[model samples]
Target: MKALAWLALAGLSCMAAADGQTQFAQKANATDVERYEYATNLDIARVIHTENIPDDICEVVPIHIFYEDSHGERHTLEYSVMGGHF
Candidate 1:
């Protein structure tokens, strides 16, 4: 019975760690997308970039990000200049 308790605890810990890792991955993917988008205007002007990608699949996905300026002016920028597929 004691052994089973230990096993259960260990399993729970592992699951928690896995969940944390998954969340971290998603944030990382979003960051990568932002970075790529920012890089587009790195040599031009000031730009802010961001994205929402699931952590589990973020690493396995190749994201195409472009900059979005919310200053009322409407324009579509190509984010593929710094293209990369995670």
Candidate 2:
């Protein structure tokens, strides 16, 4: 019983840490997409998620990247990319 309790506690702690790491700031809005700029200082520690670019189109499209910085703060970056179907 003691072992099981310890396992449960460990599991909960892991879940909480995972949850906290994924909490990205709500900076991107419909009108305010966080576009990337040249020479922008990005302190990315790990990329959490990336929006898939459509392969069938051949034009500029917006892509979103969700990442965590070195300070453990989550951020979203939106940038334009030329589509791959060109």
Candidate 3:
């Protein structure tokens, strides 16, 4: 019972979507993020940056996503390497 509780607690630490994969929340939206899973023309790299601004202004630190992608191909995205940040 205690082991099961531990597992449940660990799972709660991550947010899961319909795909049942754990993902971190990004400050940017879909438009800001570029997805490239299987591409032949682009080698993209992203970095997630966070900063606290002065005067009560919070800076949006974007997430950094890095992966490879091909041209003119339908690529499925996953939690590990899917979208780009910043």
Candidate 4:
């Protein structure tokens, strides 16, 4: 029916808006980005940074980590914190 079509269209529009908002938030919340040469050891020296987020709030911290392999190929590890239950 026409009513069902309208409902579907409305739902789709809402989803699209939500997606756009989510993308904007991600871009805005990203705090830092960095890259480093591939390290040989898995020790603490490989750590780029350590951030402390407030444990009491329900928030997310977005981090962008990029690196290159020995083969000269670049890679990305997209990491985020959502309420930090991890």
Candidate 5:
């Protein structure tokens, strides 16, 4: 019984860790829009993920980018671009 309890506790801990990592990716709709400029100071180290553009639209649309900075902090940036340009 004690061994089973330990196993269950270990499983819960793993799940908690996974949840924490996922929280880093801000929701697309919840993130603020970031206008791009020629002199914008960005510290992006790597692109973690980019929201997919809808196929039914052909105009400029908001795109959400999830990235990790040089300091290992995650961030989400929302910008507008021509749809289906990927």
Candidate 6:
């Protein structure tokens, strides 16, 4: 009975840690998206870079995008896009 209780507690702790990490990642992704969006003025953008992150843990994706403003100046920005099953 005591061993079973200990095992249950351990499992719960692990779950809590996983949840915390997921939340942290989500907040970080949101902040990055907002920051990038605010700092750029682009008429059209295209993905210049991509990296495959682990899908099991989080849904945030890293991408480098390029765009041109009205003045014909090109800008490259890094953004974290949160996408997955809702």
Strongest candidate by TM-score: 2
Whose lDDT is greatest here?
2
TM for candidate 5 is: 0.57
lDDT of 4 by residue, 1-86 (tens): 44323322433343323454444434533344333223322111122222333466577654333333355443333345455444
How would you order the candidates by lDDT, starting with the best? Answer: 2, 5, 6, 4, 1, 3
lDDT of each structure? 0.33, 0.58, 0.29, 0.37, 0.56, 0.40
lDDT of 1 by residue, 1-86 (tens): 44323322433343423454444434444424333333243222212222333344424433322222455331222232222334
- Worst 10-residue lDDT window for candidate 4 reads 40-49
Name the lDDT of candidate 6.
Answer: 0.40
How do these models rank on TM-score, best leading?
2, 5, 6, 4, 1, 3
| Predicted candidate 6 versus true structure: per-residue lDDT over 1-86, tens digit per residue | 44323322433343423454444433434334323444344343322222333345446665433333466554444555555434
Candidate 2 pairs with clashing backbones: none
Worst 10 residues of 5 by lDDT: 3-12
Looking at model 2, which ten-residue stretch has the lowest summed lDDT? 3-12
Give per-model TM-scores. Answer: 0.22, 0.61, 0.21, 0.26, 0.57, 0.32
lDDT of 3 by residue, 32-80 (tens): 4553233323322321221111233244322233222344222222222
Candidate 5 lDDT tens digits, 1-86: 44323322433343322344455554434634465444556666756655565677789887655667799977676656567644
C-alpha lDDT (0 to 100) for residue 62 of candidate 4: 47
- List the candidate 2 regions with Cα displacement exceeding 4 Å: 1-33
